[model samples]
Target: MRVFRIAKKQYLEDLSGEGSRLFGGRWNKKGMPMLYFSDSLSTSLLEVLVHLDFKHLTKDFGYIEIDIPDNLIDTKLKLKDLDDNWRDNPPKSITTNLGTAFLKANKKLALKVPCAILPMASNILINPKHKDFTKLKVIKVADLDIDSRLIVDTK
Candidate 1:
């Protein structure tokens, strides 16, 4: 399947998930780095906007397209199928193990999805870390669906 990830130009070739681990995201706290991806490009755009700490937006970002065989993904934890409030508060035990495993193995094993609306997924916790995490195909977008002031630079 094809998944999309929006990131800065400088990070276009970086998929180590180290950047995310260093900077905690909405789903995982500090020390946990997950390679976030979305089923929809529009959804990825929404995530980039919402996750930013600043209000204004002038920086340009690129869209990365990844092709991962469905068979390779082992969905150990599916937050989308959960009934509890997985967004505001995710299960600690699961997140902890996934984080620890990712740190050790380097490959993604679990899919941490907070909600279906976001359509987000990450293989940052995969076991037996992948050597070429940044080899995924990428498309630079100079103009997105939103206003130019909001985003630009899609190549």
Candidate 2:
């Protein structure tokens, strides 16, 4: 299966998941290493754009295309399986704890979960420490030319 991630140009080559570990995210708590990837490029872009402020938007963004074997994705989560407040901003412990448990269990390389930004779409959470993680390949990395209009202040 193919997955995509949008990040700053310099960080595109770093798959260590260190950034997410240090800052945490919706699914993982601080100190837990997890790589977030979207099933589609648009979803990846949207995931990043939503968290970015117009003033911080820059042209130094890039996209990564990774190939993960289908078998490596052992767990799949649906919206119904999550807490009623799973999509809450600031992230709830219910979701973070669930993800933390998944990482601690260390049974799979990737966990497929619903994207809060677009629930119909999905995101793949990668456990960098997993042994099978080495099997994932970075097939492509290139500049992501985001439209200028997206950063314009309409107000």
Candidate 3:
């Protein structure tokens, strides 16, 4: 299977997930840094839409697709299925071995290839620390890869 990731121009070629790791995100507050991917181009757009500042969006942005290894262990869950307790009481941090048991499990699975193939809205968290993560490859989007005319402001 394949997954897509939409990002700012600077990160278009980045596979290290360094930015995510350094800054941390909703899933990993302590900066574990997971390479996030979406199931499709449209989904990838929606994933980053929430983070866009229209003023700054004028800058270059692009999408890339990656092939998922068959051997990797990827866990998927519906957003609604996530436990309420998890929402109310999130982990102190998703650093080595800390956080809700389920989330921790997901983290462990992610650490394997360091990837969790979740729904596009949820994000495919990739752990760069995993040994096999290097196997993942990406195809950068070219001019013909996307139709700029089709894009529209969600607002």
Name the best candidate (by TM-score). 2
Error of 1 at 100 (Å): 4.8
RMSD of 2: 1.7
Worst 10 residues of 2 by lDDT: 146-155
TM-score per prediction, in order, is: 0.62, 0.94, 0.65
Which is the better candidate, 2 or 3, if ranked by TM-score? 2
Per lDDT, the best of the predicted structures is 2
Put the candidates in lDDT order, highest first. Answer: 2, 1, 3
Q: How close is candidate 1 to the true structure, as a TM-score?
A: 0.62
What lDDT tens digits, residue by residue, belong to model 3 across residues 83-109? 434333232233223322323454343
**Candidate 3 Cα deviation (angstroms), residue 104:** 7.5
lDDT for each residue of candidate 2 in 54-124, tens digit (9 for 90 to 100): 65767788899999999989656778888788899999998899888999999989999999999999999
Which runs in model 1 stand beyond 4 Å of their true positions? 26-29, 53-55, 79-83, 89-128, 131-145, 148-155
Which pairs of residues collide in candidate 3? 21-33, 35-126, 110-114, 114-127
Error of 2 at 132 (Å): 0.8
